[model samples]
Target chain A: MSINLNRFNRVNRKKIFNRIERTHKTAIPQAPKRPPLLHPQLDISALTDIFLSKFSASSSTYQSIDCISLVPQLVLQYTELHNTNKTLVTNLQSLLTLDKSPLDWPDALTLSTPPATGEQALGLSYATTAIAETGSLVLCASKQNPTTVNFLTDHHIIILREQDIVPNIESMWKQLSLSAEHMPRAVNIITGPSRTADIEQTIQLGAHGPRSLHLLLLAGD
Target chain B: MVEHYKSNPQGSASNSTSGPHQTLFFKAQSSHALLDNTLQEALKKAKGGFIEKRSKAIADVENFESYKQQAQLVKNHTLDHLAYYLTQFEDNLIKNGGQVHWASTPEQLNNIILHICERRDAKSVIKGKSMISEEANLNAALEAAGIDVTETDLGEYIIQLAKEPPSHIIVPAIHKTRQQVEALFRNAHDLGDRELDTIAALVDEARLQLRQKFLNADIGITGANMLIADTGSAMLVTNEGNGDLTATLPKAHIVTASIEKVVPDLESASAILRVLARSATGQPITSYTSLLSGPRGIEDLDGPEEFHVILLDNQRSQMLGTPFEEMLKCIKCGACLNHCPIYSAVGGHAYGWVYPGPMGSVLTPLMTGLKQSSDLPNASTFCGRCEEVCPMGIPLPELLRQLRNKEHEEHLTPRKTRISLQSFMWTIQHPKIFYWLTQITRKVLTNTTLSQFFAKYIFTSWYNSKELPKNNSKGTFMEQYKKSSKQKKT
Candidate 1:
C-alpha cells in the first residue's frame, strides 16, 4: 500500500504553505548572510600541520610520506605490526602500478581489490579532500572506489594528497562543487576510527568500523 | 497503543509511557526518579562530562557565537521557505532514483514502513538510533508484525535489551549504570560465566554480536540528521559508525526524518554541522558523517539496491506559524538537557514521553495537549542556561512560559494556584492594602515567636531544606527609602 502523494500535497503541504504565507506576510524570507571563514588565510603547510594534529587528537594516527609509492610498504608494515593474517583490500590502482607491483611484494603480505565482503581486515582509499578544521577525510564513492572498502575493515588507511587539503568544511564544499556531478552518491567525512562513549560514557574504539585509521599524507601530490 | 513496550523488562524502574498525558504524572515520576539510586548515580556520572566537553569544544573554536548565529539564520530562512525546499529535496531525490514518502501522522509513518518491510518480506532488520522511530513506536509495530529488529548503536542496544525508552537523546541509555548493563547483558546473551567487567569488554561483546546482525539483515533503518535539498542527500552523523553500516550493508536502506530536517543546500547543512556536534557530544566531528544520496550507482561495487526516505509531519505542520515555531530550530543536541538542573536531578524518564528537559517542557505540552502536560512547563526554574548554551538560539524558557500561559488561559492550572495568583494580583493592585499587609508581615517576622509559628506551620515547605534569613530591625525597603530621601533633603 502506497501513500497517495497527491492527497498528501493537497492536505499537508497545502495547509503548511498556506499557514506560512499567512504568518510570514510581513517578513519575506531572504538569503542568509554567510559567516566569515574561521580559518581564511592558511598556507598548505599550516593546513597540513593542523590536520595532522587534529586527526591524531581524534584517536587516529598518521605519517607524512614524501612520496606516494611508500603507501604499500606502510600497509604491509601495519599488518605485520598487528600480527594479523587479514588481506589488504584497496581500490587505488596507482598503488599496484607504482614503483613495485603487488606481484613483487613480500610473500607475507596479501593484496586484494575492492568489493570487499566484510572479511578484509585492511582497506585503503584515496580521499577526495581533507578538512583541516575537523580533520575529516572526504571520500566520494565511485565505481573504482567502492564505499564498502571504507567501512568493512578493521584497519582503514587513507591516502591524503597534500594539495587536496582544504582549510575548513565550507571550503571543502566549494572544492566538491568544482567536480562534474552535483554530489557523489556517497561522500563520507570520516574522522578517527569508529568509537562510542555509550556504555557508562566510557569511549571505546572499533564500534562496527575500523579500529584504527592511519593516514598517509602524500607530499609528492 | 504500545503500553507493554514502554514498561519493559526493567518493569516499574522506568516509568516512561508511550501515549499522551503520560506527563500528567510528572510529580510522582520525578519524585520516584529522585529516589532511584541507580538513575541518580547514572545521571551524576553522565552529567559533568557532557557540560565540560561542550564548553571546551566551544572555547577551542574562534568566534563560536558567530557560527551559532549563522546556524540560527539558516534554520529560520529554511523554515520560512520550508515548502519550497522540501519540494526541491523531493524532486532531486526522485531524480537520483530514490523515492520520497510523506506521512502526516505517526500511525501513517509506521504503516508506510511496515508496508515497505512487508513488501520486501524482510524478516530481520538492523536499525541505527532514530528518535523519529521512537516517536512513532516503530519497534513495537515491527515486532507485532513478526520482524526481528535489532538496535545497533551501543547505547540503543543496551536500552533495547532492557526494553526501556532512552533517558537521554544523544546518549540514549544515560540512566543505565555499568552494573545494570552487566545484568541486562547477562540476562539477554548466553554468556557461560564470561567476565564482563570493563566498559571495553561490554563494547567488544556488543560489537561482536551486532556485526553479525549488520551482515545478515535484509533492511537497515536510520535517521537523518540533515537532508540536503540541493543534492538530494541525507546526512547522518554518528560516532559509532552503526548508521553507515546499517545504511550500506542491507539490500534496502530506509531513512526516517521529519520534514523540518531539510536544509537549502550542503553549505547550509555544513553551517549547522559546525555547531551540531560541539553542542551534542563536544566532538569536532563525529567519526562517520555519511551523505548517502540514493542507492548505489549502477557500476558501484557495494551499497543498497533501494533507497527510500520517509518524511513525517506529525503535528510539525501546525507548529509552522505558531509562537512555538522557533522551537523547530532545535537540532536535538541535548545541551539543554545536560545543563538543566531539573533534568540533571530527576533525569529524563520523569519528563515522560520521548523528549525531556527545557525543550521537552515546551514540546510535550505542545505536541501532546497542553492540558495533559501542563505540569511539564511549570517544572522548570527558568534557569535560562538552556537558551544560553543552545546552538540554534531557541528561547526555551520563554517558550515554556508561553505554554504556561496557554495552560492558565485554558483553566488547566490547579484551582489553588489560580486562586492564590488571583489574590496576589488583587492585593498588588490595591496599594494601600498591599502596604499595610507588608508592614504587618514585617512586624510579625520581627517577633521571634510569631516568626517561629509561621515557619513551623505556614512556610513549612520553604523551611524544609533552607533556613529563612534573619529579619532586619529596620522597616520595609519603602520606609527606608523615604527616610533616606528626607535626610538628603535636610
Candidate 2:
C-alpha cells in the first residue's frame, strides 16, 4: 500500500511545526543572513590539471587518449597488464564514438549485455560529467550505461570530456536540473574506486566494487 | 526481547535479538566493558587512529570554521523551516516517480518495509549500514518475516556474521580484532582447507561472498547521509561502495533516512560534505557518494525499477525547539565517540543503545525515558571533550546535565543522593556555619596522626575500588591566605 501522506502530515504537523512556531518568533537568535554567492570564474582548461592530480592523489589513475580508434588497444593493454581475460564495456553509448572512432573493436571488449556474473575483470563506462572541486566523475545511469557496470567489475574505467567537467558540485546540480525533466534514476558521484578501512581502520581498496579506477580524459571541447 | 533465531545452513548467523543495545543499566555494563581485556585492546588500537586522522584532516583545511559554520547554518535554518523543506522534498520526490513514506515510530518503519518486500515477493534483501535501521530493529523484523537480509558493509557484515551490534557508527565491527574475525570466518565460512590468516584474506573472502548476494538480491535497503530537498535525491557517502551496489543492483532501492537529514539545496549538501569525510575517516572524499532519486528511468538499462524513501522520526521531533535541538545537526561522524575518554575506556556496547558516547548519553535518556537510562548521563566524567571535538558543535555535557536535572526532578535517582544534595544545599546557605564546620573538620581530618584511620573508617565502600587522597598536613587555604596577608602587612 502507498503511504497515507495526509495522515502522515496531519500527525507530524502539530509535533514538528508547532515546535518551530514557538522557536521562530522567540529569543533564540538566528544566523545573520549573508548575500548569495557568485562563485568566481576560473580558466576551465586549467581544471584538467586540478582534476587529474587530485584524482591521482586518491589512488585513481588517469590518462589522455587522442581518439576512440585507440580504445581497443588500450583495453587490450590494460587486460594484458592485469593478466585478465575480458573487459566489460558499456553500450559504447558515449559521444566519444561520435568523433570518427571505428564501429568495431577488440575481441576482448565484451558488452555487459546479460548483466555481469563477475567473469569480467575490467569495466569501461561513459561518464556524463566530472567535478573539478572534488575531482569526481558523475554518471547518470540509463539503459546504455547501466549502474551495475560501475560497481560489479574489478577495475572501473571512465571516458570523460574536458568540457563536461564542472567547477564545483553546485554547478553540477545546475547541469542536472537543466535535464531535470529526464532525470536519471541514479546519479553516482564517484570520487575514486571502492575502498574500506573497516578492519583495524586501515584503508584497503577494492572492497566490494572496483579495486582501481582509470579515467581516459578526452582533452577537447 | 533477547530471543535467539535458529541457525540455518546458509551460514548467515541467526541473530540473537536485534542487537545488544543495553538502554538501561549503563553503570554495570560499562563496568563490565571497562574490565574486558579484549574490548580495551581493540580500543587501544582504534583510539589513536580516529583522533589523529581527524585532527590531520581538520588541519589540512585553511579555514575549517567556514565549513563548520556553513553546515551549522544549513542545519539550523532547515530545522527552523523543516516543514517547508520536507514538503518540498516530498513533492519533488513524488514528481520524479518516487514515493515518500513517513514513520512516526520504528514499528511503522518496519511495517512499511515489510509491506514493500512482501508485495514484491522479495526472498532476499541486501542492506547497507543504517543506524536508524538498527534503532528500528529492522533486521530482526525482516528476518522474522523470513526475508534473507545481508549486510554489505565490511564492518557491518562482520558484526552480522558474529550476530553482534555495531560498536562504532562508521566502523560497526570496531570492537573486533583480526584474530576474532579469523575465528569467526573459520567457524562460518566453509572455505574447506583455505588458510585465512590476514585481514586482507578475510576482506577478499567477504567480497567474494557479498558479490554473489549483491547480484542475486531482490531488493536493496540503505541509509541516507543526507536528503536533498531540491532534487529529491537521497545522498549516501560510503568508502566501500556497497551502498552504491546495493542501490544499483536490486529491482527496488529503499532509502531509510531520519527526518532531520533533509537539506534545502545542493550547495548546503556540499558544505556538509567537505567536513563529513574528513571528520569521519580523514579522507578528502569517500569513494562513492551516490545521489539516487527515483528508480530506473524508462530508458535506463539497469537499476532498480522502484524507489522508496522512508523518513523516520523516532523521538527526534520531541527534540525540536528544545535545548537538545542542536543535537539533530550531528552527522554521525563519530568524532565525539573517538575523542570521548569514557567511550575510549568502556566502548560502545556498554552504553547499551544504538548510539554510544556523549551523544548517546543524551539520546538514550531522552529517546527511551530518562528514568530507565538515568545512569547513562551519570557515566560521563563531563570532561567536555565531546563538545570540543563535535563537528556540529553540540553542547554534549550541557545536554547530559539536562538529563541529570530531569532525573533529580523526577526523583529517579536514589533517595540517598537527594538527601545528600539537600544537605549540601542547606549547608551552603548558612555561610558562617559552613565555614566553622569546614574549618573544624579540616583541622580534625588534617590531623596527621588519626587521619588515615578516620578516612579508612568513613569511606570504606569507596576505598574498596580507589585509594583516598593523601591527607594534607597544611591547614585550609583560607587560614593560610589570612596568615600570608598579615605577614605581608608587616
TM-score of each: 0.91, 0.90
- Total clashes for model 1: 0
Choose the strongest candidate by lDDT.
1
**Fnat of candidates, each listed:** 0.59, 0.60
Clashes of 2: 5
Instruction: State candidate 2's DockQ.
Output: 0.45
lDDT of 2 by residue, A8-71 (tens): 6467554544544554564333333422433324457688787777688788888798666666
Query: Which portion of correct inter-chain contacts appears in model 1?
Result: 0.59
- Once superposed on the true structure, which residue ranges of model 1 sit more than 4 Å away at CA? A1-45, A93-104, A178-182, B1-21, B439-475, B479-490
Q: List, residue by residue over B1-490, the lDDT tens digit for candidate 2.
A: 2111111211212123335546677778877887799888888999889889888888876667777777787888888777677777888898888888877667677878988898899999999999989978789999989999999999999999898888888898999888888888788778998878877788898998898899899999999999988788889999898998899888999999998999887778877887798888887678888888787776777778899998877667667767877788989999889888888988988888788888888876666666557888887889999988877888999888877777776688888888999999999999888888878878766676565666578766566556655657466767788889999999
Candidate 1's docking class is medium
* Candidate 1 structure lDDT: 0.82
